[model samples]
Target: MILAVDIGTSSMKGGLITKEGYLFSYHRVRFPLESLKGDFSFSTELWSQGFLEILETLGASKVSVVAISGNGPTMVAANAQGKPLSPALMWNSDLGDSSIHSSSYYLSKINWLRENEPQLYEKSDLFLSCPEILYTQLTGRSVMVAPQEGYIPYIWSDSELERFHFRKSAFPEIVHMGSVVAPVSENAFLKTSLKPGIPVVACGSDFIASLIGSGAMKPGRICDRAGTSEGINYCASAAIGDSRVRELPHAVKGLVNISAILSSTGSLFEWYRQLTGQEKNNYKETMDGVNAVPASQGHPFFFPSMKGENLWEFKKGLFSGLEPGQGKFELGRSVMEAIGFAVRRSLEIFEELDLPVHELRVSGGQAKSPVWNQMKADITGKTMLIPEIEDAELLGCACLAATALGIYNSVSEASEDLVKIKHEIHPRKEFSDIYDIKYRRYRRACESVVSFYRDYPVSE
Candidate 1:
């Protein structure tokens, strides 16, 4: 068995998977992503504690190989002695200029650190993403696992790097995804009691791992993780060359992947629960109403705007068309409907790049809800492929490890052999027909909202 782990925005996850792709056991540890003023971050200490907790749960399994994947373009600054110098700049943190997208996001954040925290910046030894930072903890060696684009450790142009005054030395050595970074050190062995000298592979980012784990490696395939934020990722023949999508090199090597962000989806639901004093029973109670409500409720339209994506500017979340007698249930249904509509809207942008979305391989907290999944299918008019496992990201890391250990010829093949499709949810004709009318209304609502933001710029 190989141990595959990854650092997530809200938690750390991994498990032991057999060479053939069977996941034997798994574990997770959540860490606090604190907010300071308006910015968000999680420190290296929290991440380390999470990692060690996961290792402690694994109980010293003798693994053939070790690999890690993490979300990015998050920045983790480390001091010369390898201690964390600053809380990681999460992918969603706003660095004052909402103008900056993935093209120069990491550079901008690193620049912010250098300017705002010069003392910490000057003492910084490296700016590694979560994967490299976590792997370095295990091996006592550091190497930045390169992402194709959309993520940091990307192929940084010297001019672009200089534009942000990015510190070249602050970055770790670049290495290809799945490369054997180094052997595990004795110090790491003491923490977990695993044998020393195990080859550690620097698996790519978490988003790519989600694709592999869901078997969405081919072009037109999408791996959607509808959790805290909605991640809409699809494989493409080449870069769409559109800002609407964040492009990255695929784990398959030849193809590329384009990811779109919703900034809010599941989190919107959680926020509503908090507002309604239903935090403890949010899922069960809201889902009850979700099932009770049918397609095309024709209620209010909700716009989730907390985490703005590539195309739209950050604006306030809005709920329109409210009337008397429409209570929290209607609000809940509207949130669900809006989530579906927002997904379709994002896909329209993908289609503009000529990257037709074939199917959505979805996994996350939202994936457990058949009602929402059906709503998504009806709204998007595409089939939803739900994986057998809840942790596709962790499974994706397993695919990377399998590839690194020669267990599979490629990540694509590993996914095919191992990733099982539990069920496929197809679009229902009746629901689609109703959603057609509601979708048209949704389009108009979005246009109005965008126009409002344009006229009155919050300047986010």
Candidate 2:
């Protein structure tokens, strides 16, 4: 059996799986990451605790190798003894004053620690991204991810490291995502009953896992991993020179990964669910509410802004053009439309770059909603491919694990065998113009108020 763990944004999930890709038992555990909302600070301790909890709860056994993946572009400072120096600055942390983008940059956080906690920084052993931290925690070895393996910090050259006034020595020994770092050590055994010296396969970002799992390695394909946050990625045969989307080198050599993130899509929906209690814990009623009603027809336009960055300003989400006596259902429909509009916005940007989206492979929270999936298809006017597996990212990690154990000839083969498609969603031609107009209105609404927020970004 193989153990695959995904350290997600809000939770950690893992399971025991047969080498042939059959999941024996699955489990998930959500950590209290919101304890520090200011910087999204989370206890590094919860990572291991959560992993062990999953292992014990599932009663997993015979784990030949473990492949772990997590959120990245996040910064974790470690001391000489491989201890975390501070609470991890999560992927969405907004504490950066240099620039909003700088906040997510690993190097920037290193400098911040050097200034703010110089004493700890002095004793710090190395800095790591989220995935590497988890891998090192189990393997009892500190290392940096090879540039080609992860999404962020694409710069690993000596000259580039020097440019930041950071020495390459301050980082872990570079390792590729699929290679074995080492067997689990005695330290890992102290927490769990798993035997020591089992090869620990390296994994990269959540996006990395999903891309391989979605089978979006081909050119002109797109993977819409719409989870807690929405990441729309386009796999291209060559590097796209457009600045509209951030690019990562794909797992398949020479494939350029073009992607964009909607900071508050699914999260905004969860927020609304908690506020309205329309359907209680799940989104069935909310999605049903959206489909049961016609388009708002410009009555309500939602910004869907929750800590939006890289824009001219920072603004919270709002429902504009609300009328008197608008019920919770109306607000719910508007929010759904708002999220669909956000997807359209990302598709439009990708279109502008001439890498028109041929098909959108949708995963995560939105895939559970056929209504929401169809709405995205209609709004974006693109075919939507939904995977049979909800945990594409975890399955992707499984693919990496299997490859490391030589279960498959290559990553491509592992994905082809493991990642299966459930169905495809097509646009409703009848609703195209309705969404077309609403998307235009959504854009105009954003333009009208963004400048105000830009000038006065202070939160009230």
TM-score, one value per model: 0.87, 0.88
Query: For residues 69-94, could you state the per-residue lDDT of candidate 2 as single tens digits?
Result: 88866778876445677888777776
lDDT of 2: 0.73
Off by over 4 Å in 2: 36-40, 96-104, 147-170, 187-190, 277-280, 296-299, 305-314, 444-460
Positional deviation of residue 396's Cα in model 1 after best superposition, in angstroms:
1.3
RMSD (Å) per prediction: 3.5, 3.5
Alpha carbon lDDT at 70, candidate 1: 82
lDDT of 1: 0.73
